[model samples]
Target: MHIPDGFLTTPVWATLDAIAIPAVAWTARRAQSELESPDDRRIPLLGVMGAFVFAAQMINFPVGLGTSGHLVGGTLLAITLGPAAAVVVMTAILILQALIFQDGGLVVLGANVLNMAVVGVLAGYLPYRLAGRGKARSAAIFLGGFCSVAASASLALAELLVSGVPMARQLLWFSAGLFLVSGVIEGAITAAATRAIEGMNPLWIREARPARPVTIAVAVLGAAGLLAAGIAVASSAPDALQALLPGSKNAGIPEGRLTKIVLGLAAMILLYAACVIAGRRIARQRSA
Candidate 1:
């Protein structure tokens, strides 16, 4: 779910932005290292995969009660492109959505990225790896996809509560009910996509590796910091949600049916080109 700007208090989003910047930088570095020897196929695959994810996120299914959920594609990307590359792809998608569509708030861009990209990918990938190979691997893919959405929703709910939204507990339960169903849809999509991709091109699915101890420690600490900051800031501010509502209003882009199709095609082409160039550069560097 893309959080609009006004849902989070200034302090909460600000602190998350700080944490998100460095986390993204780290992910980029990791991706560069991982893709240093990228095969010719991988560059195109990255672009196509990223574009696919971007397009998929635009289709929101009605979850009843006027609520809707779209495909996040974190686990799908991770399963295909590796976690680091998935993070980069997701970051690109989020940035484009924020800047071009105004789908998410620019001010809370960091938090949104952190919640969807970093946390979602890791939550999914870790479980998939732990489940191992064979029959369990298929189940793990479903579990990973389910967990990714659920975890993201949980964090978003926590953020809302910390922002002093009224009836936090009630809203949390309501949102959870919606996501429970949505998560199952995501899991099925992920499992099907994984199977199709594996059948067509096994190389696209990278084997999962355990993170080094230091990396794990840092991630844990970062997550803790985000949670603590949200709680601490929320406790101090009175009417935090009210204060944010004034400036949080979003005027989104309106496009015709043809325009939407054209724009989607253009986005896919642009992402593919960008990824190809980056992949080639990284490949050259390694060769040199």
Candidate 2:
């Protein structure tokens, strides 16, 4: 879902970035405020969980068009972290993806972050909250996650359209039509991951900062070394190569993809390393 760099003109990217900068800052502040209650520990937990979600995204799912998409994991984070903080966690994930993995472009970072982080988390969590406590929890979790994925995909398509991308109708139709498919997959993945984490340490289920240093380290490494590689190759070769083979060129990258891949990976890798070290330190402190 990383809209490569250059997909949008300079003006659009610049405008979106300007808006994203403040929006992200506001989200962080909001998360901090939310942490003032009984779930202070959820702050670190959410951060680490965000990293884990990044790790899971490395496993790509084939969409059958010779192109594949990975899990966004927004709902999974929201289910565990709560709404406000979930945005912060996802913002971190998106930043790392755009910068280190080259999954998305820096110019379009704001749009991607807003769609995947803010919209997904808020939409997903609303259903979960409405479902209310206990036994209904899993059902709420699935629906919330499903809705989030659908909403994120729709919003992303809309952003692309508004940015003056050429394939507005096609892109929107492609994305929206896949909603049911994406929704089912997202729901199942979110449910499974949440259940696994909750089962591993029920305390995590109750909202405590993650204290697993090793898990944090592995997650960072996975995103940086493995997933980043996936993003790099996935965005570059297949689409571009296909474009060169007669009749396939029309479906190929829209000019600036190469640049987006380079810049995006560079940014994501740098951020991934920084986040890993920071997360490890936080994990160590929590364990101590």
Candidate 3:
């Protein structure tokens, strides 16, 4: 659930933007350290996973209530790329999606990054970390996928609600139901994919690491900002929220079927190339 720019108040989006900047920096640093295992395969795998997730997010399914959902791919990335690297990949994906495709909002890019990249990936990786190499590996994979979508959707909903976006109680219920179904489907897809990958090469799944306090702290800070934003929005005038929501109202994709398809494919290629180059740089650094 990519929260378009108009969906959040100024304070909420700005606060998330503030949090996401440093969080992303920290994850990039962590990613470098985490990939220090000298495995060249992991480098190319990073590009592949990023491209796969980027492609997967483009094909949305109707989730009702005039909204749609996609595979998201945060869980799968975390499982394969390691959480920190997953965060880096997702940040790239979101940035490209916002900047080039206009599939999301530049003004609220930080909020979307916080929701899906940071919180979603970590939440998904939590179960795997807890059940490392245990008999419940399959269950953990499913749970990771479930938590990834649920956490992201819930945060997006809260952002909208706290932004004073009027929603019927029934509509909220419908959203919860839709996300629940989406979560289950995500879980199944992730599990099946993991099974197939393991059948071919278990090493593709990043060996789970112990949970880190700093990682948890980053997530907690993001959530806490969300909570504070919600409180502020709850107490503010609806008119105030409406006024703040229109930051860069003219910012949207141009309408044309052929142009979009061409642009989309071009963007995907550029993103893949960028990720591959970054992966190589990181690999070279680690090797050095």
RMSD of each: 16.2, 16.5, 15.7
Candidate with more favorable, higher lDDT: 2 or 3: 3
Clashing pairs in 1: none
lDDT of each: 0.71, 0.66, 0.73
TM of each candidate vs. truth: 0.70, 0.60, 0.71
Residue-by-residue lDDT tens digits, candidate 1, 69-139: 66779998887777888988888888988999888888889888988888888777765654535446788
Error of 1 at 42 (Å): 5.4
Positional deviation of 270 in candidate 1, in angstroms? 47
The local lDDT score (0 to 100) that residue 237 gets in candidate 1 is 37
Candidate 3: list runs displaced more than 4 Å. Answer: 37-44, 56-70, 210-288
Question: Cα deviation of 185 in candidate 1 (Å)?
Answer: 1.5
**Candidate 2 CA-lDDT value:** 0.66
lDDT of 1 at 204: 75
Pick the TM-score winner.
3
Query: Once superposed on the true structure, which residue ranges of model 1 sit more than 4 Å away at CA?
Result: 38-45, 58-70, 209-288
lDDT of 3 at 167: 76
